[model samples]
Target: MSEKVVLHYFNGRGKMESIRWLLAAAGVEFKEEFLTKREHYVKLLDDGALMFQQVPLVEIDGMQLVQSRAIMNYIAGKYNLYGKDLKERALIDMYTEGIIDLLDIIMLWTIETPENKQKQLSNIEQKAKERFLPVFEKGLANSDFLVGNQLSRADVHLLEATLTLQEIFPTILSTFPKIQAFQERMKALPRISKFLQPGSARKPPTDEVYVKTVKEVFSHIFK
Candidate 1:
């Protein structure tokens, strides 16, 4: 069955991907309105729905929520993925922020010039192998989750980041045994397992065609 997403963003990873991950992890059903044309973006602007004039603007519970980080936090909190207490939530926030740093590089990779693409990819591999993955690997050293010994927003975001890295660098986690095990465990969750299956709402990796479409659709922003 085709997945119906509930959000406003281009049909690519960008910032919306994290939101998709959270909703999928929660087993929540939603619909997404892809803004492929300038008119689509303009519609949001015209409707005054975008608080900051950027996506991923999400429509849920009769409220138009903009800003990707805010949307993610809201979803995480709503789904009981945030944490059990304030300290746990803070740790989740801290860990997820690091994961976001890794995702930002991947999301920006599509725009890098041919000259810089290889360099960027190399940098990503280095950071993932050296910095990011090690952090998560060690975080999961004592527990399956990154925080509070249970699934939380940090775990969800970390799982999403690992998947994205594997999509680009398939063998990136070869040395990170803990993360490898973590991936298997996270994917086994009924909700996340469903999301990992084919024909899910998950977006594909950014490609030439997607980049071209994005440049045309968001010329003002990209330029």
Candidate 2:
């Protein structure tokens, strides 16, 4: 029998894109349970379905998993996308953590307050310049992929982070030639390219409802 996998998350991509990308790249057939209603999400939390009270939960092979990174790591291990050995896996983890750091800053922009919005924009610019972007640029200085010479989970996470940031700040990667080139290279992959085609589910939030919904869902955390 085929493996049964169900991914639960909000309707938008947000934290779940990398996991979705991994499944797609691995040619895994899975079901998506998008929580489109606020009450539905709260219901899951109240029912103890979410251990950490977060979305992007995955139910696979008789196991339910929480946390985006954990789910991605599990899937990557199954698909051999983690790395070849211990040292390579360590480097991949390092790069993945760095990408998550960037993702945290990008997520801060979802808050709808004027002051917080401005602060997040400034923070993204600063972090991109002094921290995240430089790290990735240098990391990619020797190879197109972030960890090892092959396409590891780190590269997938980095692509997601780069695309997320690019959506908000279109010209953010102009100064970082290597990172920009890496983004292009990753997008050209057969699986990823198809996943990114027009009308694909991989598209991130771009409409007014996206901002409103994000603010509503994250109100507790942002406040």
Candidate 3:
């Protein structure tokens, strides 16, 4: 508990970003190492730091964790952001998974060609409105938290996912007042408020430069 968490990823918001959100909300201090070039990634691969040869790798509690979901689960449990009992945990899992599915569509935007970005962004908005946001809006209808009477990882993920969408379309959440309120409430937390400030570890939306860097770093897959 004394050692700080270490996160590895690109300079932009990729999968590691959600991990950053979870850590910040958990009040755990973390240091981020941005992958600036192919060599940074290659070094980790050669050092056996990445379990599945991927980024978003985290070092915490003397372990090198990979996979965003797994890393999140560990952080949630450690920080008591997971619910108290099995049933509550199951509910939290359900809501968290749904939020992640929506986030997946946002990730697809980074690979979009210049001509396709707007079309792809429209598609993302459609899914967020029709499929995802409504679910959270309903889940949060009568309570401050999603699964239980307290804040959990599900709440944090919901907030992060909505914020990411709003980055592209500022009015995306205007129709969902409940989620809008929930987003503000989460941001007001002392730790979370700090993370949202300028010059924090929170990365901006991926841009052309970030896309090019990622493809260059992992050219084998983007092909």
RMSD for all candidates, in order, please: 2.7, 2.7, 1.6
lDDT of 1 by residue, 32-144 (tens): 78878888888889989888777788887667888888888888988899989999999899999999998998888867888888888888899888888888888899898
**Pick by lDDT: 2 or 3, better one:** 3
Residue 204 lDDT, candidate 1, scale 0-100: 86
User: Number of clashes in every candidate structure?
Assistant: 7, 0, 0
Q: lDDT, candidate 3, residue 98?
A: 92
RMSD of candidate 1 to the truth, in angstroms, is 2.7
Candidate 3: lDDT of 31?
Answer: 87
lDDT for every model? 0.86, 0.80, 0.90
For model 2, how does the per-residue alpha-carbon lDDT over 1-223 read when each residue is reduced to its tens digit?
A: 2267987776666788778888877768787877776776788788787998888788887777898888988999999898999999999999888888887766656644677787678778788778888888999998878877788988888888888888878888999999989989988898888878886668565455766775676577646
Write down the worst ten-residue block by lDDT for model 2: 203-212
Which segments of candidate 1 are over 4 A away from where they belong?
A: 1-5
Clashing pairs in 1: 4-30, 4-31, 5-30, 5-31, 5-32, 6-31, 6-32
- Candidate 3 lDDT over residue span 170-207, tens digit each: 99998999999998899999998999999988888888
Model 1's lDDT to the true fold?
0.86
Order of candidate numbers by TM-score, starting with the best: 3, 1, 2
Candidate scoring better on lDDT of 1 and 3: 3
